[model samples]
Target: MPRLPYLSGVAAATAVVALLAAAPPPSGEVTVSRPRVVAHFDFAQGQTPENIALEPDGSADLTFSAARQIAHVTKQGHTRIRATLPAEANPRTPVVGDDIVLGIARAHDGTLYVTYATGTRKTGVWRVAPGGAPRQIAQLPSNGLPNAIGLDERRGVLYVADSVLGTVWSVPQQGGTPTEWAKDTALDPVPGSEGGFGVGANGLKVHDGAVWVSNSDRGTLLRIPVRRNGSAGPIETRATGLGGIDDFAFTGRGDTVLAAMFLDNELALVRPDGTHTVVLTQEDGLSNPTSVAVRHRTVYVTSGAFFTMRDPNLLLADLGERHDR
Candidate 1:
């Protein structure tokens, strides 16, 4: 773990932008009263980050599509390439989307699970073990396209949200056929906007006993209750009106759900009451943020330039930055 002096979170936030102005390369960590830009990367010109996950030990893993790679960012700010996902294996799956990762998660045993789809071969899921090569874990039916991945640490099950198929399927964490947990055709893409199945849902996380799914096109966060048998309850919409929700994570011990709105590039906090607070806005310098994770009161958001047209960079905000308290 990279150790930096623990300044008051406030002090760290205030110094970040000032420090950025004085530097050539971005300094890795930024501390603020609450919101600080701890790390920033310029998406290698063409490539952009899709998702970001903080390792239990405090390091971060980021996935980039245009660059065809995944990188591990140390707590101290150093980034090292971890893997080059075989985009060459299949072309159907996007290289990256709105900074949403190819899908990165850690199993209970600290094994990293990364999932990406190829446009060519839509039936397969890739499993890459730590210090090992990538292997094909399962090949689904012809029409199945695996989008986002989530892990049920206790049960050793992996949840896949396939927007293309309008379904959420759970596979054994070790790898196998996926059982449908929930599905809604309403989420496919609208006829004019982007075009697709209408529902743009993916980016899944298992919290408490429920699997929270981000419906990007409909702009809502859903909680699919996972029973003991791993089947699901009626799909419950947890919060709505988020602009194009993509992916999100729990914050501060998992009390609040911090969701990233892909269209608006906003980070919205969903309280238990189903109400939301706009924690970060594009005006705060976020553009197409796809995934969000909270570590020790700090919110780490990853965003892409959006396709080949937008500016791609990762934004770190100290959650307390805007709080005067």
Candidate 2:
């Protein structure tokens, strides 16, 4: 196991709440049925809200990648900083060019685990307890771009998806060296990805006794069996054709998923049968949505606005009568 770095004595920042307005739905899409916006970014809050985790009280904890902070959103639609990443955690590599926090997941006990990259070579995961400074938990490989994370609390393990390396890694919940749990050709980048990022295994989730992941470039969803012996088994394709899939959450129905299609500027409802429905689109006011979180029948989405970095927002809508089980 690699030696874990102790990040201590980093000054924590005070929480900042911002006043925001309800974003009107995009004009032309008015006739098209889709999820409506409940909360939109005020720009005074933060930019590039990435991944979100649902709190016990039904609020959401969001990662603001560009701002390098974790924010909490109340169920009633208010936003505030929950924690801030220390300067040392920011990556300084040329490949990625900027320090960005990508994925966040909450444990049952309320600890938040985050994946961040300063560059491809400086990727790591941090654990942040409520009202505490972030602590480095594991250091990923220098060549891997750590993105989304998933927790298997029952097994006391954490799973991280490395988009650049096309691999999934497992780390001890208590903090230790990460091991490559699974990798396959299906996790590779699809031909002709626009950006140099080459995103492969992006979003991750542990559900139904398996580890599910999405390949952003390929837009493929796959699952790896978790054996009784605590090892990962063969990988299997669950669904595909979800272009530019980023972070996603499972829907109320088994085998159904709500995914954020980043490049397509849409929200997608995908099933194991390879059929997908565009629940929201650019015309519906989604601008480069990077993540999705579902709590009961309501769905929350974060638009990073990566291209323009303008009008980035957190949108919400109820899972109404449209979806099929």
Which has the greatest lDDT?
A: 2
Top TM-score hit = 2
lDDT of 1 at 259: 78
Q: State the C-alpha lDDT per candidate.
A: 0.62, 0.74
True-structure Cα RMSD, model 2: 9.8
Candidate 1 TM-score, true structure as reference: 0.78
Residues 231-305 of candidate 1: C-alpha lDDT, one tens digit per residue? 788888777766467788886544467877655556776766676656566677676677887788667787764
Per-residue accuracy of model 2 over 146-261 as CA lDDT, tens digit each: 88889989899999988878789999998989998898878766443343236688889989999999997676889899999878899998887766688888875787788888
After superposing candidate 2, which stretches have Cα over 4 Å from the reference? 1-34, 42-46, 88-90, 93-95, 120-122, 190-197, 322-325
**Residue-level error in angstroms, candidate 1, position 90:** 6.6
What's the TM-score of every candidate structure?
Answer: 0.78, 0.83
Global Cα lDDT for candidate 2? 0.74
lDDT of 1 at 113: 71
